[model samples]
Target: MSDDELGSHYTDVPGQRVVAAALRAAYAWSVRDVHRNAAMLEIARMTGVVMEAHGPGRGPVTPLELVGVLRASLGSLLAGVRGRPAELADVVLLDHEGRLTENAYDLVCEHVVPLKDVVGSRPWLPSWTTMHSDQIRQQVFTAMIASTKQDEYVASRRFLVEHPAGDEQELVELKDRAGGVRLAKGGYRDVPEDQLYRAPNGKGWWWPCAECRWPMAVASSGKVRCRYRPHSAVFDLVPGDRPVLRRRDGARRSSPPAGRPAEGAKCVDAGVWRFVVVPGASELRIAAAAEHAGAKVLLWPFLDRFDLLVEAGDEKFSVDVKECLSLSSLIERLRRRRPSARILLPRSCEWQLETLQDALPELAVLTETKFLGQVRSAMRKAR
Candidate 1:
């Protein structure tokens, strides 16, 4: 399949590098301490998780059992940064503790890989960003802890998107406000430091998504492109009086124009876009409610390894706030990760209770109404 057809998973070269940087950072994190052997083993076990092969006596897979496979998979995924000792030093990844490396900031600025070269022929595995390294560590740590028992450990699991929310009114409102598609300025390849354009505010100019008005990424080809390709358009940077967006048809516009799709293109599906943002909006609401009710709440706590952690006086809860559009995908991830936190669903996805119960009967799944009630009860009891 064409790279363009595959979406950001392929065409997003900078994103891929960010993924590579994230992996390299993970490599560093795994090897950094006394826990290295355990960490590597857990990673190997997690890597070996095959959805269909999951059953009794299927795993408790050790890293040594799959080191060759894990190494091969990681090496191929990050071939671009291989053997670059100096560059690797410059690429900052999140440590196991969730702190960003001081020197790793803006690591993308130092390296660029070609768009075509980055489109590898491998099945993609979902991974958290570099910023979430600590969260990933926590997940693996939890898994490792569970594995030592020789008993099947499905860490406080839950099924999301078992069905669909009956009432999505609040979600709809939130989507209309902040969930619109956005864009940004990007480059196809690195421009000389002298030639890089700066805005009036002295910040470097980033291309904006024509439809959403969000900043797009500059790519290895030195052309500006949108990470969200459904809003992508064919364009080039015209370096005349100043750098500007020029359509393939030779039309020009002021920078960062928003609320309109690219020439001859339809705006991306609103439903598709809403799935990405509405959950976040719901999370904000949940966090606000917790705070208003006199609790200490952390959103995306510990690099967003878990969604929300709440402490109301003596009571505490770790929550994985979920709003999944696809029940299958949600189930698959839950099965693979087996998070230790309780999974909370917003009003937007209340309908999935039965299916979730059927699949993961032991999971502590709560709807928005029940969750809020629990929070209120916890706060009152604490007080």
Candidate 2:
């Protein structure tokens, strides 16, 4: 792949040509056994994925099929036919999690490998632009959007036919109100044109959407390109080096007793419900003054490390932090009624939850499920 050839296909950004050339170089290095043109393309495609998903300043978010695909990519032993190689299936895998035993990897000769390899190879920029044809790339994206709601649609692979040129395969387009394929600009690598065809004039998906989901890609730029959202209001942005920490939500609320005036600090030991102050209680005084009585203390952690998971008596108060992002105002109001609860958060982040934890040194960062399980186990033991 030459820079001039790629620059011609991509007409948007002039400066991007240099970026594209650099990406191709990285891609060329990633594939060691490239002998011919087709094999080279396949390797580039894989490299494009690595660039997109794990690119700089981006979360290495794994896609659903990634683990399985990675195993296949790694364990694939190839037979040298001429200069290129062919893969043979002589591998078996185990799923220790038992979630999906079909795809797992075992090392040390005893380690079970997944049926297929779906692992990260590296990150690259604008992966789609590198495909053999623009239409194939567009179709891949068409199916990806369907993957967003995998149940709703599959790519019209059944009705697919060889392109009029007899060189490429084409999946039909998804027609909106107008007669053309309708695709959202964001996350889609496809550009619309006469090549965008529809199945039976817009009926079915020729291929399964789930398989074609393009979660990330390399940029035509030297850097891998992934979805970039605005800095969440919850995160505080600052200038140069260390970012300032701030809360997107309100300060956490941990009330000792909603209706209390028990003289001073009272230490009641009753079991799991035998919740006593570990140490810090600046908020206790606030509760005594009736400032933050029953407000819930929600701890938001990085990658959902420690959620607001707890159980008090017969009532359960654990809420997955990620799910809380989708809650309505009324539900949030109702959740605040919980009095006195411990919220574990990431040692990092300036979310109000962390601030609350700072105010309450007794709060712990529940790092593992075992620690979380122990809390519940203690509560059960107390019961």
Residues 120-177, candidate 2: write the lDDT tens digits: 2233312321321222334333543454432222212111111101111122222222
TM-score of every model?
A: 0.34, 0.18
TM-score for candidate 1: 0.34
* Cα shift from native, residue 165, model 2 (Å): 33
Q: Kindly list the per-residue Cα lDDT of model 1 for residues 225-274, writing each as its tens digit.
A: 44333344645655433456656545444343322112221221112122
lDDT of 1: 0.43
By lDDT, who's the top model here?
1
- Which residue segments of model 2 deviate by more than 4 Å? 1-39, 42-201, 204-383
Candidate 2: deviation at residue 31, Å?
16
- Model 1 error, position 372 (Å): 1.0
